[model samples]
Target chain A: MTMLPPPTSKKLGLVIDLDICVGCHACAVACKEWNDGGQFGPLPDANPYGAEPLGVWFNRVHTYEIEPKEKGAPAMTVHFPRSCLHCETPDCVTVCPTGASYKRAEDGIVLVDEDKCIGCKLCSWACPYGAREYSEQRGTMQKCTLCVDRIYNESFEEIDRQPACVMACPTRARHFGDLGDADSAVSKLVAERGGYDLMPEMGYKPVNKYLPPRPRRDGCAAEPTPAQEEKVDFSTSPLLRWIDKVLSR
Target chain B: MRPAFSVIFFTVMSGCGYGLLFLFGLALAFNPAVSGRIEGLVQLGVGAIFVVAGLLASTLHLGQPQRAWRAFSQWRSSWLSREGVASVASFMPMVLIAGCLWRGADATTLRALGALLAAFAAITVICTAGIYTSLKAIPAWHNRFVLPGYLLMALLGGAAWSWLIGEWTGGARAQPALIVALAIASCVLKHFYWRHIDAATPASTIETATGLGRFGRVRSVEAPHTEENYLTHEMGFQLARKHGKRLRNIALLLLGPCTIVLALLAITFQAPLHWPAACCAFAAAILVTAGLFVERWLFFAQAKHVVMLYYGGARMHDA
Candidate 1:
């Protein structure tokens, strides 16, 4: 039962644009808020007001400073949001001793069936992306469901269905759709922006992709002339010269 | 990577148990005269105690210990599940062999059951090693050294313990030279493993992790959170170089020279089935087990998981 299913062509995933992310953590906050009470409710936080607070979150954002490759080019900061990539050949699912962790063949979403999980934590170790979250209170392994409940819920408005992180991104940095479709908006965006997979050499064949930061124009090799230091010609306008003389007196 | 006490205890205890079980089975099948009925029963009882204790200790590591039985369902794909199944399956032959010893069964039946038990015991140990070797996320464990290391160490510990038991019961002694050879081989394998990890570079780096290598050098300026999260808590354990070196030295001394010398001393006094040989074997057994404990601890503590790349551990080996 832990064996992986054949590859799915309907791979639904996210395409995150690093060029526009402001690192405000709104997406992460929205994910916690929704998943905390939505289907995967009560993401427990230990010591809420104490010195050390620990909890399970489906998404997290990291910021990194990149030194420009060219000497004169300015350094840039990239806000990186990380979550489950929903890998095609995730070892996390196959490594499960219990048939708890699995990847759906329909949408290529990796999920943990909490009811069957024995909390062995082997799946957590198998994940190179650190996506699996262990809940101390529930005694089960939890992870990013990609908002499976909301995405397929017919009760919600058609426009309201999507991952909480993607929906809440103010800069619209996150895009979600069926990446398997070549003509889909998300796929086109990926192709146009050169979207690439993170740690491709890991060979997980991640469904999610990231668009790199665009080049900036601030580092162009050009000097500006100082216009502020130019002297005014009083002889050109006699009226302007008379007004200036009166003001000086 | 965190080196949980429960897991370390489980592996070490179980390794000794299975090792002893294999040797016992081998002796019973090849030469029944080496052990009397009472001595055979005693050996089986000891091995069973250690095996049961180890299995119980492993359950403590699970968050839901009551659901451990579910783990046996996925043996088709998971090495951990296979290990669970193999270990439980092995107990059947163990019980049958015990019945044969107690009931004075025919030599042919006893030999068949003993051979089955030995095969089962060895397979269980292999499954145990497979659990770590299958994990490609940790480079230190996903290597050729880990498999042989586990096998050799288990045999050495078992041989030493069997020597002690044989001396105490006035039965046939296990070869002292075998113990010495096993000890030296384990030492050499451990050295190779340590050297391999020390010189190895991580396959995944922060640049690859973020897919930003074209931008130039990437450094984490801000962490996702101020408080430590589950990933960091479980995988970010860092052993200080000074302490790691000291512990490695201690493990090497106890397992290598100390064990070899004690084994040699046991050989010198083998003619007299008295306190001298027994004491040497007993001391060797105790030191070997203690040394293995330290070695196992280092094994987990030193492993660097690839997920550390996201948390400012730019390179896996550097972490």
Candidate 2:
């Protein structure tokens, strides 16, 4: 008898704040570090320094400029960073010809068993997210496991076990927690800030929620204050005096 | 939707094999009181060879062929699983009935079992077709026309096979008429499937995919990556537009009327048992099967998966 895997409560997911992300690609590098160290092994590279360098990576941060308004963007550019949304109804698992791909019944994290994978590349095709990357050297599939090996390690401190991207982010844009639990930090954050998922119409019901960029403050003045004179000596350069005279004229 | 060669071969060979048996089923059913026991045995015996050969070829594609039985386990949500289950289940009864029929067992029990095999034969044909029809993601495949198209194909393709066997042992009396009708129907079906798929809106437009408004201006200025990725290799097979149209027409010409004429020629010469008709029909179907493979390839290649929008293929069309 076959049964659909139970939907789990310990839903590991990410909350990405579009407001603070600067597209530094730290998360992508952090992800590669952890995935390489754990179950997925090293993502091999072909022609590392040659004409066309290629390799498998579980995460690749995409940068896209947004106007966000009809007028050309007056403010700094809004960079969009994309990764696997870890959708609740991931089509990749169901489309697998082998049982190597599965959704976790414990944490709602989708994963592929590298040992059982035949490298047929069907899961990659099935995933509309383009989440799964094939490791050509290993001939197996690799994806963000939600840092399963780190999140559950008994040796690490409770807070230290979160995904490397979440821990390493300097701007604090990425939040990690269980979305299924109402009292969880992510759920509260989502409820308060009006967080939204990307491409919700796709109906994947993505676990990760993106907090839309907050609207800029109105009536904010832009000026250079007189306090600037405290640090610089105007008498130092004749060129500076000439610029000041030209400004006054 | 990956154009795996093994799968293409599996579908074609099985389709032809199943078609031949389906015609044999109709012939046995058409004559309730016929007394050609030795001849019936030979026809059934020969047809089974093609069926088994096609099925055996399919196993070569499996990664872990030893675990092939596990495919039957997940029939609930999976159409591929159901196909494997139905195919294996259908094989058992067919073998039993054919084995008995070949031994000249025309008893009431054997005849009843043979009828059961015929019903199961239809199930096998439909189940095989269901593998593609069930995929809701591929708009070209998941449609109303697929069900009847497959059923019609089985009956029509089966007619040619039945005609061959009928000429060999049963006589060419009713086989030619069945082939004529089947040929026309098959031609019409292929046309409808092609037409419907060509005109349908892509499942999602680039705007809808990118979360832009339906009428939003979206275009791909630059691709995200320099080299092709796994997603592109597995899904991004593109066929030239003009060539596909020409090839589809070529398939109809080669497989459709060309086959019917050969069967008709065999009829005119009173050489139903002659090699020309069977040879021509067999060769034409193989060519058409190749053509259908290309058609199936285009079905996947032409489909714009929603994710392609993110990598700057955000071109929008009228939904």
Which digits, one per residue and each the tens of the lDDT, describe model 1 over residues B1-319?
7998889898888898888889998987887655788888877887788788889999988989999999999998999999999999999989998888887888888888888888988998899999999988888898899999989888887787888778778665567798899889989999999999889877888999999989898889999999999899888888634488789888889899999999888778878467888899889889999999999999999888888888883677563
Off by over 4 Å in 2: A1-3, A42-55, A65-82, A118-122, A134-140, A168-170, A214-249, B29-67, B165-174, B212-224, B240-242, B263-287, B314-319
- What is the TM-score of each predicted model, taking all chains together? 0.94, 0.81
**Which ranges of candidate 1 are over 4 A from the true structure?**
A218-249, B240-242
Scanning candidate 2 chain A in windows of ten residues, the lowest lDDT window is A67-76
Q: What count of clashes does model 2 give? A: 1
Docking quality tier of model 2: acceptable
Q: Candidate 1, A10: how far from true, in Å? A: 1.1
Chain A TM per candidate, in order of listing: 0.89, 0.83
User: Evaluated with DockQ, which candidate comes out highest?
Assistant: 1
Top-TM-score structure, candidate number:
1
Question: Interface RMSD for candidate number 1?
Answer: 0.9
